[model samples]
Target: MKLERKHALVLLAIAAWNVLTYLRFIKALVDTEDRPTGYYVAHTILIVVNLLIAALLGTWGVRAYKASKASQNAQV
Candidate 1:
């Protein structure tokens, strides 16, 4: 269950991406005022979808991290 340093680093990068994407999505939603209704609707849908996907991936990464840590602890 242990992730090599390289693999862990990759997962961490993915987690960071998920976080950044979600944050940017929120910023877009907040800044979408005064735009045309069609533009706002499209952006809102895109943001919501991106947020949902990011959330799912983040949960998976967290579970993997916890499992790896648990394995390391058990070996100690």
Candidate 2:
């Protein structure tokens, strides 16, 4: 399916939000005390997975947006 400008924007927004929010979460996680080893391990894995997802989304969004603009320019 073709990704419209709006879809690209949404994906970019989600990617940005995930990066910003998860960075803050990492700081909080570091500052917290007395967490079990398993807790930190699980959360670290979660953060890694989410960050990977964000990277993928950001890449897709950027490529789609650039393609849309290029197509528009070509039509002119």
Candidate 3:
């Protein structure tokens, strides 16, 4: 299914937002040095959670966009 310009733009914006928001967690995980094992573990968990959320959001957005496009095509 084809996404219109506006739909594509919105998807792009959401993806960008997801990446930007999660980047801090990733940076923390990467940049921290001489930390305790528990500290690393906590950051790892946070990063995993962030990735899961982003994946879920991306999947939902793609499915919704495709469904809308399919419905529009059917009506035409």
Give each model's whole-structure lDDT: 0.71, 0.93, 0.73
Candidate with best lDDT: 2
The sequence of per-residue lDDT tens digits that candidate 3 reaches over residues 2-75 is 55546754765676677787787687678879989998888787777867777776666677677777877988
- Weakest lDDT window of 10 consecutive positions for candidate 1: 1-10
C-alpha lDDT (0 to 100) for residue 2 of candidate 1 = 56
**Model 1 bad stretches (over 4 Å):** 1-12, 25-34
Residue 61 alpha-carbon offset, candidate 1, angstroms: 0.7
User: How many clashes (backbone atoms < 3 Å, residues ≥3 apart in a chain or on different chains) does model 1 have?
Assistant: 0
Winner on TM-score (2 vs 3): 2
Clash number for each model: 0, 0, 0
Candidate 1 lDDT over 21-68, as tens digits, reads 778877867876687888878877887787677667666666677777
The alpha-carbon lDDT assigned to residue 41 of candidate 2 equals 96
lDDT of 3: 0.73
Candidate 2, 5-42: lDDT as tens digits = 88889999999999999999899999989989999999
For all predicted structures, in order, the TM-scores are: 0.64, 0.95, 0.69
**Residue-level error in angstroms, candidate 3, position 57:** 1.1
